[model samples]
Target: MTPAIITKDLTKKFGDFTAVNGINFEAARGEIFGFLGPNGSGKTTTIRMMLGLLPPTAGEIQALGISVKGNQAELQQRVGYMSQRFSLYNDLTVQQNLQFYGAAYGLNKVDLKNRIQDALAMAGLEGRENAKTKDLSGGWRQRLALSTAILHRPELIFLDEPTAGVDPISRRAFWDLLYQLVADGVTVFVTTHYMDEAEHCHDLAFIQRGNIIARGSPARIKETMMDGQVLEISTSDAIKTVKVLRAAQKAGKIPLKEVELYGSLVHVVAPNIEKKINDIQAILKKAEIRTEQMAVIEASLEDVFIASMK
Candidate 1:
């Protein structure tokens, strides 16, 4: 089957600066494809080019098997986009917003009525249709935005950091809705900074400095990108531990590849971490920091991302 989205050397430049530099990837049909990266990593630039909102300086993009160059209007009708801001008319009632969007998409009166109801149900706002959009919680607003974006039943949807500020629970719920869409054959292309969210995608690409550094299934990225094993160290002071370890590494005291603080734990990455565990413990002991536990653990997406960045 043809991929839902494809790009080759997709690049964007703003005069002297390059926002997206020679990126290439594909999103399969009916799958959640994640564009993972830090802020200012050109993820949004790539999305805008794919959506035909911004013209690329060079390279090509084919979305849903249609060239994105001059066929923007035609493509717009078949694709949905939920921007980072969760575009909605806050002053309008829930139903009113849906009605407006449905009409904007050129839905007929009867189709608009039916799709509004479906969107309301999908957003879990059945009884809150008359409620002003501003009165809804962030989670509710997010769902409402998604509902409006897909009111036309488009074949593909582009979501730019859809869960950025929402709480974890709400983010999970939003992803549940994404899964439901995929189950119904809709393709999802999303960009996110959350490592956990990246794990949920069927495939992902990590972008940095306007370039794609890694792209693959989560498992594949972990297996292929990680050059070292991760060793999780439980300590009373994670922040201090990270500082100390980083200092030691900078001074060539330890051969660790990466040292980062994860909540109350410190993760140290290195090739064959088991052999260096004793040295790690000795270093912490010298600093009067007690090591509660240490074990080799599976590398997380964040770990792989950091390693890839290096």
Candidate 2:
């Protein structure tokens, strides 16, 4: 069976600069594919190429079993898209907004109304269908954006940082909607900078400087990038310990990224964690520092991304 989305060496260039530099990627049917990257990593450009909104300078993109370049109209009909910072008519009621977009997509009045209801319910905005868009909060607006994007029941959805700047609750709700879509066999391809949000994806493609640096299930990706163990140090001297280690290691160009402070604990990412563990003990002994606890643990997805990006 054809992948829901496929792009081989897909590229985009602007005069002397290349935005998306020969990136290859694929998304499985009914799967959630995340494009994780920082700002200006050419994620948006790649998405545009995949959606056929912009022509690629090189390579090809196939979506829903059709070449993006040759079958853009049909592809668009089968795919839903929600862009970052998208604007809907501020004055339009939710129902009116849905109806207008539904008609534009050529949905018959009856089907359009039913889909509108379904989208609203999926977005948790059923009762607010008559509310003005501007009256909604940031979270509600995001839900509305999602509702509008999937109003036509497209086979796949492309979201560009859909949860950026939203509250955690809103982000969670959005993921719930994504899960529902997956259950219904609709694929999700999304790009986001938020690591916490990226963790929610089933699988992720890490993009760096327009290239895919890593692609796998989040857990697998995390494990692949880390060889040594992560030590979690919890004590009254967490900050003091971090300061001592960082200062001591900075001169040697230690691989330690930073002393990530987690509540009352300090997570130390290092090579030969057992050696580091012994070293930490020696330093704390010398510094007369006391810790409530210390243990080695697995690295997180954030650790993997940081290591890969570096």
Candidate that scores best on TM-score: 1
lDDT by residue for model 2 over 1-310, one digit each (tens)? Answer: 7999888888889998888889887788999999988788898888888888888999998898888888877887899988877667789998888887888889998899799988887888878988999998888888888888888889999999888888988888888888999999999999887787778888899988888889888888887777566788887677788787777678663456556666677888877877667667766777778867888877877767776787
* Pairs that collide, model 1: none
lDDT of 1 by residue, 40-110 (tens): 98988899999999999999999889899999888989999999898899999999999999989999999
C-alpha TM-scores of all predictions: 0.98, 0.92
What is model 2's C-alpha RMSD? 2.1
187 in model 2: Cα distance from truth in Å?
0.4
Off by over 4 Å in 1: none
Give the whole-model CA lDDT for all candidates, comma-separated: 0.92, 0.83
Model 1 lowest lDDT segment of ten: 116-125
Supply the TM-score for candidate 2. 0.92
Worst 10 residues of 2 by lDDT: 253-262
Q: State in Å the error of residue 74, model 1.
A: 1.7
- True-vs-predicted CA distance for residue 145, candidate 2, Å: 0.8
